[model samples]
Target: MKLPLSRRARSAPLPGIVGAARLDIRTKNLLKRLRPGDIAIINHLDLDRVSAEALVEAGVVAVVNAAPSISGRYPNLGPSILVEAGIPLVDQVGMEVFARVAEGDTVRLDGGVLYRGEEPIAAGVVQTAESVARATQEARAGLSTQLEAFAANTMEYLRRDRNLWLDGVGFPDLATDLEGRHVLIVVRGYQYREDLQALRPYIREYRPVLIGVDGGADALLEARYRPDIILGDMDSVSDMALRSGAELIVHTDREGRAPGAERLERLGLRAQVVVAAGTSEDVAMLLADAKGAQLIVAVGVPQSLEEFLDRRRSGMASTFLTRLRVGAKLVDAKGVSRLYHPPRPQVWPSVLLVVAGLVAFCAAVAATPGGSGLLESVSAVWNDLLDWIRDVVT
Candidate 1:
C-alpha cells in the first residue's frame, strides 16, 4: 500500500535542516530566550545591524521571519549580516506560523518551506546573499525619503525637549562625581566589545568615571570592570549588574514615568529618575556634560549616518543635538584607542645608563691596585661568551 504524499515527503530522506523553534514578536525579548542552534522565529521588520549581530552571536542555525526582513526601507543591515553568516533565512512566512508552531517544537526547513512531521506549516521566500544585496541596492534609492523623515523627526524632538537640551532640565544629580574628570560612557551597540577592549589602556590610565548605558553595564562586568554609574530604561540590563554597586539613574519619559523604576523597586533597589525625551545614550552624554565632565569618551555609540538611521527611532535627533552640546568634550572610543597611545619606556636609554655606570666603576677600579688585571679578566670572559654565541648562530 502506498502512503499519502505528506508521509512520503517526510520519509524521503529529510534533506534540509532541523532545529527547535523559538518564537517571539519582540526581537529583543526573543533574543534572551534563544539557544544556540535553535530556529529563531521573529516578527522584526527591516532588521537592524545590532539585532542581526545579536542573532548571529546567539548561534541560530536558521531564521524564520513573520514579516519582511527588508521592506526596502533604506538598506537595513540585518538581512545581509544573517546571509553572510551562512544562516538560512526564510522571509515573510506570515503571522500564522506563530499559532501553527509552538516553542521548542522540532521543525525542518527545506528551501523556503517550514515542515512539522510531514506537513508543510509555512512557506516564504528564501533570502540569499544575492537577494539581500539587490534589495539593499533598491533600498538605497529610498534614502532621500528617509533623510526627509529624519529631518522632520529632528524638529519634533527639538520642539519637545528644548528645555532639557538648552537649560539642562530634567537631569538628576548623581553621587558619582563627574566634575573635571574624564568620563567613559559605554553603550551596547556596534563593535562595542572590540571598542571596549581597545579602550583598556585609556581606561587604566585615566581611570575615568565608568558609566554603562543599559546592557553596557553587562559589557563592563564581562570585561571584569564594575560600572560607577548605570543609566538607561533598565530593560536590557541584567539584575546582577544593577546590584553591582553602580549608582542607578533611570531615564523616564517626559511625564516622569520610568519603566525601569518599577523593576528596580521589585529588586529592592533605588534609582534616581531623569525625565527626558531622548534615548538613554543621548541622556547619558548630557548627564556627563552637565555634571562638568572635562572629557567624555563614548564607546559603542553609533558614529555614522547609516548607524544613526539604523536605530529606526526619532530619538537619534537628540543624539545629534547632544553631540553639538558636548562636542568639545566628547570623543569617540575608536579615536581615543587609535590616537592616544601611551609612551613606552625606552630600553636604549636604560642600556646607555647602565653602560655609563659600568664605565665609571671600571675607571674607579683602575685607580686602585690590581684594577687593570681584574678588568682584563672580565673582558676575556665577555669575549668568550660572544664567541660561544657566534659559534651557536653559525
Candidate 2:
C-alpha cells in the first residue's frame, strides 16, 4: 500500500541536503546560534567579507538569504567567499520564508528550493561561482555612486564631530597607562590571526600595551595574550572575556548613551564609557593617541580600499579622519612584522668557547709526565662505556 507524501518522507530517505533551519535577521546574532550541519536562514543584504568569514567558520552546511546577498552595492565580498567555501547559497527567497519556517525545524534544500518535510516552503536563485562573478563585475559600475555617498558621509561626520578630530574630547580616562609606551590596537578584521602570530617576537621584546576592540579581545585571549584594555560595543565579545580582568571601556555616542555598559551591568561588571562619533577601532586609536602613546601599531585593521568600503561608508570615513588625527605615530602590523627582524643570539660562539677550554685543559695535562698515560686511560674507559651502551641497545 502506498503511503501519504508526509509519511513517505518520514519512512523513506529524504532527498537533497537536510538540516535544521536557524533563522535570524541579524547575521552577527545568528552566528552565535549556528552549528555544524545546520542550514542558516538570514535577512542580510550585500553580505560583507567579515560576516562571510564568520559564517564559514560556523560550519553552516548552507545559507538561505531572505534578501539579495549582492544588490550591486560595489561588489561586496560575501557571496564569493560562501561560493568558494563550497557552502550552498540560495539568495532572495523573500521575507515570507522567515514566517513560514520555524527555528530548529528540520528542512531540506534541493538546489534553489527549501522544503519542510514533504511540502516546499520557499525558493530562491541558487548562487554559483559564475553567477557571483557576473554580479560582482556588474557591481563595479556602482562604485562611483558608492564613492559619492561615502564622500557625503565623510563631510557629515566631519561637521558633526569636528571637536573629536580637532581635540581629544570625550575620551575616557583609563587605568591602563599609555604615555610613552607602544600601544598595539588589535581588531578582528582581515588576517588578524596571522598578523598576531607574526607579531609575537615584537610583542615579547617591546611588551606593548595591548588594546582589543570588541571581538579582538577574544582574538587576543585565543592567541594566549591578556588584553590591557577591551574596547567596543561588547556585543560580539564572550562572557568569559568580559570577566578576564581586563579594563573595559564601552564606546558610546556623543549623547553618552552606552548600550555596551548595560550588557556589562547584567554580567555584574562595571565599565568606563567613552563618548565618540566613530567606530570602536577609530575611537581606540584616538584614545591611545590622546593618552600620549609614543607609537601605535594597528593589527587586523582594514588597509585596502575594498576592505574599507566592505565595512560601510561611515566606517571608511571615520577610519580616514582618525588616521589623519593620529598620523606619524600609527603603523600597520604587516609592515612591522615584515620590516622588524629582532637580533638573535649566536650559539656557535658559545660552543666554540667550551671546545677551546677543553682543548687548553688537555694540552696542560699532556705537558705533565704521567698525563699522557692518564689521558689514554680516560679514553679507554669512554670507549668501554660506548661499547656497553651499544651492546645494551642491540
Candidate 3:
C-alpha cells in the first residue's frame, strides 16, 4: 500500500510554484541577496541546519541544491527543516545548472521537475518529510564510527598541542589592557543574538572587554555594541565590522600564512597576527586567559557534540584544552544570565515620599505667622535681582 502525499505536498500547485530565482555558489554569500518568494539556487553539500534556517528565514519558495543535501556522513537536519517548513527542496540538481540557468530567471517546479519556461531544464529528487525522516534514521545509525573518529582526532590533537594544555604557548601581547577585567568573547552560534540580549544589563553594569571572533564582530555590531577586539581568520567578517575601530587580530596558519591579515593589508588596514593551529574561538579564549582576564564570559560557544560537528571539526580538542587552561574564569553566557539578576529598584517610593514631605513642609510654612513676611522679603530680593539683570542687559 502506498501512502498518500502530505497536505504540504498536495497544496503546492500542480504546474508547480513559479518564482524568480537567484543563484549563488556559496550559500552564505547567497543569503545576502535572498528575498521572500524568490527561489534559491545553491551548491551546498551536506547542507547544515544553520544554512537551512537562513534559507527559511529568507522566505524562499523553493531551494534547488546543486549538491546532495545529505551525503549520509551524519544525520544533517538541514533537508528535514526545509521539508518541514513547507519549502520544496530539490536535491542534487548537478553543477551544470549554475551556468545553464542565468540569475534572476523565472523558474517553475512541477513536483520534482524544474523548468525554465516551456523548456524543461533540471530535474532532481524532491525531498519530502517522510524521505528526510528515513534518511535521518539511517544517518544516526552510523554515529559509532563518527564517535570513534572524533576520539582518535582528539588524542592526536592533544599530542600535537600538549604545550598549549600544559603551558600557555605563544600567547601574544595585545595592546588592549585586560588585566583583572571581565572579557566577553562572542562567537557566531545558535541563539547568539538572544543570549546577547539577555546579557545586555551585565554589559552595561560591568563594562567588560568585548572580543568578536570573525563574523562574531558583525553580530556585536548588530546588537549596537562595538567590539574592543576582533579576532579570527577574517573570512566571514564584513568590511563595515573591520572598519568599526576594533583592534584586529588575524589568526594565521602554523606555516605563518595569514589570509585574513593579507586581506586587511590590501585594504590598507592594520591588523595583528597570531599563528595558531586551532579554531579562532579557542585562540580568543587562550589570549584572554593569558592576558589575565578575571572572568571570560562566552556567548554562542559550541557546547554540544552536534555543535562541534556542525563546525566541521573532527573533535573538540582545542576547545577542551582552551577551557582547561581558562578553568574557573571561563563561564558560558547562559550560566551568567541565569545566576545574575539585575536589582529591582525600590527608590521611586522613597523619592515620592520625600517629594510629598517637601510639599507638606511648604504648606505648613505658608500657614505660619512669619510666612507672609518671609514671602514679602523674598519677593523684594527677587525684584531687586531682576532690576539688576534688566540694568545689565540694557
Best by TM-score: 2
Candidate 1, poorest ten consecutive residues by summed lDDT: 308-317
Candidate 2 structure lDDT: 0.91
> Across residues 1-394, which tens digit of lDDT does each residue of candidate 1 receive?
9999999877787778899999999998899999998999999999999999999999999999999999997788899999999999999999999999999999999999999967899999999999999999999899899888778878988898888888788788788889999999999898999999999888889999999999999999999999999999898899999999999999888787655677898999988888788799999998998889999999888888878878755676788889999978999999999999977999999999999999899999988899988989999999999999999999
Could you give me the TM-score of model 1 versus the true structure? 0.90
Alpha-carbon deviation at 72 in model 2, angstroms: 0.7
Candidate 3 yields a Cα-based lDDT of: 0.85
Candidate 1 regions with alpha-carbon error over 4 angstroms: 1-12, 255-259, 365-394
Number of the candidate with higher TM-score, 2 or 3: 2
For residues 130-183, what per-residue lDDT tens digits would candidate 3 score against the true structure? 888888888778878777777787778778766755666776677899999999
lDDT of 2 at 387: 100
Give lDDT tens digits, candidate 2, residues 1-394. Answer: 8899898877877778999999999998899899999999999989889989989999999999999999997888999999999999999999999999999999999999999987999999999999999999999999899889888888988998787777887677788889999999999888899999999999999999999999899999999999999999888888888999999999877687655667898999988887677799999999899899999999988888878877765677888888999999999999999999899989999899999999999999999999999999999999999999999999
Off by over 4 Å in 2: 1-12, 255-258, 363-377, 383-394
Ranking by TM-score: 2, 1, 3
Global lDDT scores for all candidate models? 0.91, 0.91, 0.85
